[model samples]
Target: KVLRLWLFCQNVSFMAAGVAVVAILAYPDGAMAYNHTPFICLVVLINVCGALGSLSTLAGTILIEREWAVVISEGEHPSFLAKMNSILRRIDLSCKLLAPVVTGFIISFVSLVASAVTLALWNILSVILQYWLLMSVYNGIPVLSRRGRFADESERVGFVSLESYSGWMNGLVDHPYVSAWRLYLKQDVVIPGVALALLYFTVLSFGTLMTATLEWEGVPTFVIGLGRGLSAVIGIGATFSYPVLESRISSLRAGLWSIWSQWSCLLLCMGSIWVKERVSSAYMLMGGVAASRLGLWMFDLAVIQQMQ
Candidate 1:
């Protein structure tokens, strides 16, 4: 239960920290008016915030999903899990589409700081929602809150020291995080899956570079955000199409499509490196950005299908 609470807190805190970084980055003129050092630091801080938020959300969500998987499984309902999973994917895609475009519109029409403030307020609202849902669902109590769990048995487990707790958690090497890495090392199929993961994210790393380069180039924030948002909109179909793909083809086979799609489409943007015109280069970059995202979402679907 402590672990669960810690995860949830980290989840909220990560998001809060991320938005705070955005607040720092809401420079109206694109690049900061000050020295490059502060700008670089803020950029690095935002990247850190993004990584932390993503990892924490991934870990917490995976933990919760496994709990749900136990209670609601294919054994009980044939298509229920798949249907719910597809629905969740749709919701996630919808958010992805909405957030950026909305942010773009705000930054276009309003002050940069206003956009940040809006995001911050939304996150605060989420914190409240998160608290409400948790409290209602579990009575805001630990899982092992029953009398027996707190009973004065021979091995009383009421409280534990920090060091003891750390040791205990470390003892659970079979935990998902640990086991996943172990499986990746021991299993041959997992290597290609990992490679696929690497390839997809590596391509999408360009998205970060694209953001920085474009911001540096003085591209309007709204245009940059809109282009990225539209690309995500285009990729939604690809994301939701994975289940149907699994029905028709083997997951392993389908996963290869993830790799093939991006590498192929990205070829169109190869000339961006050599192009001198800022406008042409900007178009090329947008093409690469969109193509990169399209492949990534498909890779996400393939990963869950085959790797998991």
Candidate 2:
């Protein structure tokens, strides 16, 4: 339980950082530029960069977590601190995997903000390049195929099939679209994809009502906003619960990874929007949101691995 709480807190911290970055980028203005140019662009860029960061971060974290679990589960391993040190060491080494790309994003963001060149053009190009790079990494890795190297390692360690686990979960839960699907590979389950799509629509409907109808200044408005915000949190939390729970029970490595991945996405989305609203840049916000979603999808495989 300590480990679980610790991981959750860490996940929240990561997301908060993302949000802070976005907010910082937006603070140049009066915190209400939701219709401005720079703000929009910043929103998009943050979302994209954030998503990429989340995916890569999750992958690295999951890999290290699993490695740690294997070591600790052996029963004769070193003390807990030593095991943690081992994980940190591995994470440090793996930093090379994402540090360069993240650095590139930082450089690009700075360039766009500092230069007088057509900000929109540069922002668009940077987003495209960053997204392409992220996609390249996702495609290059066969981690999601359930027959890849990571999957093989998991299988050797008695990891369960994602499909089987999803099926079992669906059997127990009342929800329809909670089952697992790899990219486009939908299994023959009773829950139709359409029904699953409806869940997202429902969430969006609630978000829209909160943002559009509820005021934000008065006490009544604050209460409404708070409730709506909590609803959104619950929605996002629900999306991540299965992965977190399974990871805790089956493999702490996978759980941490999944939690981290979701945190990254949440950060990207929140940060990008915050930046856009502040700086008035539609491009940035769009880029950030798109990137975050793509990252989440790409990292979905690792989340599934936790159940195994």
What lDDT does candidate 2 reach at residue 261?
Answer: 57
Quality of model 2 by C-alpha lDDT: 0.41
**Candidate 1: C-alpha lDDT:** 0.62
Q: Write the per-residue lDDT of candidate 2 for residues 136-223, one digit (tens) a residue.
A: 6445643432234344432333323446546657464423233222322333322333333342452223244434433332225444
Candidate 1 off by > 4 Å:
2-8, 11-54, 64-71, 76-83, 104-117, 131-180, 200-206, 215-220, 274-278
**Per-candidate clashes, comma-separated:** 0, 32
Query: Residue 49 lDDT in model 2?
Result: 58
For model 2, the run of ten residues with the poorest summed lDDT:
175-184
The numbered model that scores best in TM-score is 1
Assess the local accuracy of residue 246 in candidate 2 as a C-alpha lDDT between 0 and 100: 38
Give all candidates' CA lDDT scores: 0.62, 0.41
For candidate 2, what's the RMSD?
Answer: 17.1
Clashing pairs in 1: none
Task: Quote the positional error of residue 271 for candidate 1 in Å.
Answer: 3.9
